[model samples]
Target: MISSRGRKIFVAIAGAAVTIVALLCIFPFWMVVIGSLTPENEIYVRGYSLWPQTFSTEAYKLAFEDPGKILRSYLVTVGITGAGTAVSLFIVSMCGYVLQRPDFKSRNFFTMFVFFTVLFNGGLVPWYILMTNYLHLKDNYLALILPMMVNVFYLIIMKNFMRSIPGALIESAKIDGAGEFYIFLRIVLPLAKPALASIGMFIALNYWNDWRNGMLFMQDETMYPLQYYLYRLLSSLDFLKSAAASTIDLGDQVFPSESFKLAMTVVATGPIILLYPFVQKYFVKGITIGAVKG
Candidate 1:
């Protein structure tokens, strides 16, 4: 019922508002990048700016001092993220498909069983003891992948989305002698692309950002993910400053501590940021549809 001019004006205003919000979200990241490039002395004197008066690569140089070690850590993280996301997506989608099957008996019981874990968990001590003492995942890559391979929340979202799939299609496939697995792999999966993309992104981000598993279950420096590797670097910096305050002059200008922190953020986040655009369309569609279903 709105006039054409009103609609145009409304859309223009909405577009402008959205652009402002996007810039607001991006501004902090821009500042961090600028801060990383700005010299330690310049930052101390002039604070953060949209553009730096002087630039330095000292922070990046310090971080990559041991290029071999940094590269190894990156490989480990990339491997973990890739493997974990794929495994998680498969397991989650399979479980979702099975749970949403109309003929499956005791589906509600199994669903509740999965849901219960989300509400409560055995405390950290039990979890650590189970991982290290029982599973013997110490210093193992499975330590990184297994624990996070399935999330109950993702399971729920995927199940809800799969429920929207026409049951008649599954029934017809079965009548045509197509097995459940075939139908799932060929038909259901293709139809659930949006949900798969959405949940896959979440799983990838979880594995990418995870540091606790590395901290707790991994002891070998060679196996440490990029996040834990960066965490170790920061921890060492803190320890050095505290323990060697008098004997060592590890001042801000010497170490470029502030800029070093910003540089680490830039390095750790760069690859994952590149991944967002690929899945963004599917992600938006999937989350909205999945969230509203049950």
Candidate 2:
């Protein structure tokens, strides 16, 4: 019903808006890439540019020269992310399914218990002392996985999504002589794939990006995760003071610290950036399911 001129104008405006937003998001990343490839001396002299005036692989070479540390950290991060996601998804999904069941007695009380923790957390000092002194989890990988096992907000979102499933489905499953665990594993879980995938990615990203836990609990440099290793490298000038310090002499090692920082940032972010597209559909679907159901 619109005139040809008006339709063209509307399309042009929308296209321009999208282009502007896309450029805003992409320009910073481009700058980082250019800056990282730019020689350290050149960056100091010429300042930042969209294109590297003198491109060099020095930063990447320094980063990967003794790939042992980075490789170990990658293994630790992968293990934590995979294990944590599986455990967290299982616990949260099961809890959420039970919480959403209409006939479950004391469900309101259980929900409140979970929700209350979100509002009022135990203080940091107490948590640190408890984990380190009481639980004796310091320097252990469990410290990374156990503390973040259940996120209340995610549980609430999953519960809300589960509530949207027809009660008749669960009732029929029950009548078919299926146990609760069997029903959950076989029927409910399959239907909850979108929510599970979204929450799984959320948990995995948390584990992968976790540097604070490593800093707090892991005293041994060898146990340090990738983010923590990168953090220490970026912040500390005397990188020889920590793990793998003895591998390179302070006098002989020539590290482009600034470019190295940028390079590490790119490496740490690369996985999630690649993963976002694949998981984006589930994320959208999960949010829509939660919003409509909750």
lDDT for model 2: 0.83
* Predicted structure with the largest TM-score when compared to the true one: 2
Sequence-dependent TM-score of model 1: 0.82
- CA lDDT of every candidate: 0.83, 0.83
Q: Which ten residues in a row have the lowest lDDT in candidate 2?
A: 240-249
Which residue pairs show collisions in model 1?
none
> How far out, in Å, is residue 121 in model 1?
2.4
For model 1, the superposed segments whose C-alpha errors exceed 4 Å read: 1-21, 61-65, 238-253, 292-294
Q: How many clashing residue pairs, candidate 2? A: 0
> Model 1 over residues 11-79: C-alpha lDDT tens digits?
999999999999999999899899989998888889878999888987777666545666787899899
Clashing pairs in 2: none
